[model samples]
Target: MAYDADTSIDLTQYRSLIDLIESSAKRYGDKTAYVCLGKATSFNEIERDSRYFAAYLQHHTELQVGDRIAIQLPNITQFVIAAYGAIRAGLVLVNTNPLYTERELIHQFNDSGAKALVVLSDLLPTLNNVVASTQLKTVITTHALDLIAPQPQSQCEFTTITFTKVLAEGSCLAFTPVSAKLEDLAALQYTGGTTGLSKGAMLSHRNLIANAMQIKSRLSDRLVQGEEIFVAPLPVYHIYAFMVNLVLYFERGGCSVLIPNPRDIASLIKTLSEHPFTGFAGLNTLFVGLCHQPEFKSLNFSHLKVTISGGTALTQAAANVWQATTGCTISEGYGLSETSPVVSLNAPGLEQLGTIGKPVIETQVKILDLNDQEVPPGETGELAVKGPQVMSGYWNKPQETAMVMTQDGYFKTGDIAIATEDGFHKIVDRKKDMIIVSGFNVYPNEVEEVLSAHKEILECAVIGVEHEHSGEAVKAVIVLSSLSQDLEQTKADILRYCREQLTAYKVPKIIEFMESLPKSTVGKILRRELRN
Candidate 1:
């Protein structure tokens, strides 16, 4: 399908991401830019704080241009400050999840070669245990409400710097603006490695700027400069929310209400009640959970207009109930971590439920058979994409990158999709067996690796099972070396061990014991048989 005339946007307006941020701050200086914890931050304030942060990093820390700095934070005003500051200082941003376990943290920090990290104070205890293992030198910590309310803070047990101290000291130093090119490496977005360990997808400045423009063009009708307010319940650390809240919406002169904890449904509803929000961004689990709440059901959605669904598939039940409750239909979109994350999005009034809408502007999609040949329309095949929004390749893994990229330059999405006669596409299945729990990717290989480390487990395989709340959940089928009569205790003990090694979502919900798993002559476990 050709690019929709309605969603067409100029792709080359911004020279760099810094250009995008500074220009927007110039245009909407006094307007409200972000809201969190009952405090509103203005565009001018973001620009100023971020500038101070840049000056501090340049003078105080040994971090230089092109170095990597990780930001492990929730949706707060300080995240905006640290990200923009790091960008302005000519450093690459590594958006790390605060919920990451020590094992996961060690891999990402080491892989990215991150020398510095700005993290929430609550994560300090765990981080203190593993910071020495990585190449990290400077650690900056802050409370979630630290910037919102200037209170006396106790020093961290480990030697570290405070966020407020950086700002205060940076004010005395002079900041020299660093030159940036569109091709410069901006951020290292790590993907859930379905086949193995997660690898960083190097996103360039051009890729991010173009994606922001592409997504804005898709929502051209709904977004108004300086007039739109969006409630953001998604984690900003994820690329989906990162692109939307920090880049796309901020550049458009809009306000984003940041929700620190989305699992607290009552608090989220109460926060929604406080703002006459014009937009909301969420996925299936959030939509279903919110609609079932009595307080959410009774709230006034009179001003809500645009609701976006991404990060996972939108269920028919979720779509139906959301529209009935808010009188607004969700524009479900599709993308992967390798695509700057927005491949296609359904327009508000024209959304076709159960199908991802047309490809965004300047994006091309092809359905390919197992032989790498394009399949005829109305048939399911692996979806491949070519566009400005696609990442250059996997970071530092040239061979792995070459495997995914075709000779023709399209990136194989590893998803089974059907190209309809109408422009919209339906994702029927996945070519890779990757589980998505609560809109977060949970790869079986990673979980299996952790499980195999246990002394009791001889053989193990992980698979995704149907879950009503999270869309899909991780299930482990195992064969222990010795059969024990106390099955319940073994399960509980294994679960406890898993919680220590894996992130919350990656932990298997169900554990089933079997004599042996079905395997081929080559001795490879078949996850499909386990699923069956």
Candidate 2:
């Protein structure tokens, strides 16, 4: 099939995600769209369910168009329904992390001013505790098996409804169409803030649609619409997976096998064994972990064609192991939550092992020095991007948005990279202090804030250190309140406190107690000094 660069996949044809979904569902009605826990949902089924959920929002709730609704669930069939339904109803989707602590949850919900939330039943207790802190008017919950099988009725203290109940009730109600333009805000993808808070990246419909089209164009030669099956272990809430599996692949009429918990290597391997997946989306740590599993290595790789590596840098060791085990080369890409998550991806069979391949279609990448002047090719500098897929700005944060955007309209990526003479881009280092653990962003300020809040701790500093398993591990240097004879027990106490407050990955793996941390004249703890 000869792919047309201009008209093969026109992104401008769809104004919103609803338009995209409606067209795709109509085109591939009977094709399987998503599979989770042995239950497969066809394209038509996803469309119907998403419409029902949207109707429920329209009739059952007071939420107006463009209102933010938080979705905090793991990768499941319910997540897909909730996301598409929220977007279709003209609501701004807030992709919440399911593992967020109460403090993190409070900040995001309050910051986004989410009027509604669709969360997992398992996380109801956590939501219950924090519901009073937000402006949420409605709460809907669903279990992992809710779509697969019937569940017994359960009641909650707050006014909450079940996911099935919404679908049932909304099926009978009329779905009033909401006019969402391409320039309308679609999702508020929150990125880690250096100020110890998370800021939402305002992604418009055009931003998402354009990136999906850009990604589709890059992989058009390898991907067969309605024929490819993708193994999506990464959380759909993350932009990388959201754009690839949910938007791009979904529009391509591909089947996505959702692994709710990829951390469970045994279950992940078991899931992979059942499907002859042609595509896999993952990162360096996940790639290394899966390739190390003997059972994973034994799985059928005859059908696997493209395996994508993103979120963090792909090490040569991981790439070698994955190719040796699966017979599929890792196509590493680079992007941020601000860029609708994809600036460039490696061309499917012609992947350069270490570098994130050339910039995707309609995307411009430039390496600039401190003076904002473009550097010579092959020289290291800050990578700046300009494309239709770039986010408009941070949600409700003008000053922060101004800080990231250049006068000439490029978004500063904060990553140091070198554009090769061969057109490939290689990431040299991160200009920011953000730590990536298993492809999840972990900022030192957020972790340090939680640690310093402990009554037993006087002060602390956090930094990313190289690790064999996770690409980077959070390492903490602490200054104790007082001299303690039992330093080991004190360290244990501090870690226990962190576990209660911070997420699992943000908790420090290595803790070192010191009299004082290296600091500048202003008393700001030098994280780079700590890293060294």
Candidate 3:
């Protein structure tokens, strides 16, 4: 395959993701592809296992081509196997958050109409309660250490199979080939919607393939194929990590060490000490958290060359601390799930500290004003994007898809940004009332909807408040059904109620009680007034 200088990608290289995977496996057969929990899987081994998984889906299940399969696992070896296998089996992948509540799970599963679920064994109990409510027909579960060590057999009420058993059974079946086109839907990536329900971004094989190529073009000079080792702590289910680790790094014949739980700084630092990692992908809060630890500062940084930040803004304090501690500079990028997650990234050695750097090759980015007209350079406006990597549209929701796209074919990102004369882009503000805490997006509507479900809550509004730790913290203004003299106890009770229904980041950090929430003439809660 030849690299195109004009478009920045060689479209003649491969047809689909399967083509890329098969070619890389053959090119780097004996090379280590992924390492997790002290176990390394080579490219050949990954190819074989994924083929066996595809065989199982073809012969055992009633699922047909184009059916959706939901994968609800964290960073693990099985996640890679299941995702690739699903694609190979001609099924669409739906990446599900493992931390999602039952209500969230129900909406995503039902909305996507996923026919099969590949999930962690620990989450099977949660799945058990919701599987009956979904369209799931086949359930495969695996332990975190299933690939590394043997586990005692556990019983379940549902008709479920263990991950190891599936692999063993699949090996007996003959694999069949299926034709998939670049325009075929590969995955349904769910993102927070303005209407309070999560919507699936219909990402095609071309979108994923194009984004991978664009990233490669941007960082080709720094990346050495078959030689680089990446420390992947961010969840692979997210599009940012998914494209960088599973797609780009895999295509480059590089090895990625997956961290199942990145919240454990002690464990993460210990893992870092064991490898001569050449690349690392993280965010602002993660960089700050790890750099502040003495154990992390003691690790060897001689082999570290690339440190990419995305999913949220990177603070200068975090960047400076990281550079001073590890002798490696942080390169921040910007994108959303709708764009296969990367629109622009700062190239190493030419990074601009607070800017997102230049747009990727073949991608068009513009700032548009309220009237959908292109804004002048240096003026803040809604950032819009047009590229092959952008999603076709939201799944099963044409109206919602039409709402985000303009007549000119650009996807309107609800973010305010300014383009510098030098071609760098800087984010100024967000057009939506969404809070980003530690790189995770927390939608106010979702939080407020969950909080309003509490029996004692009469009305509530959620707002983003500035925080020293997380970029923003969720704050709730509430008007109770009945006036309570014990305000402190009532606040505690409401918080306790929230933890059950919402994820930790989505839960409000501070709660204030008001006699009545401020409303507009139209009778809607004025969140801007609450923010003031």
Candidate 1 local Cα displacement, residue 61, angstroms: 0.8
- The TM-scores of all predictions, comma-separated, are 0.98, 0.97, 0.97
Q: CA shift at 271, candidate 3, in angstroms?
A: 1.2
Residue pairs with colliding backbones in model 2 are none
Superposed Cα deviation of residue 80, candidate 3 (Å): 0.5
Relative to the true structure, candidate 3 has a C-alpha RMSD (angstroms) of 2.0
For model 3, what is the error of residue 389's alpha carbon versus the real structure, in angstroms, after optimal superposition? 0.4
Segments in model 3 whose C-alpha atoms lie over 4 Å from true places:
1-7, 153-155
Q: Looking at model 1, report the run of 10 residues with the lowest lDDT sum.
A: 1-10
Question: lDDT of model 1 at residue 475?
Answer: 97
Candidate achieving higher lDDT, 2 or 3: 3
lDDT, residue 182, candidate 2: 88
Worst 10 residues of 2 by lDDT: 1-10
> TM-score of predicted model 2?
0.97
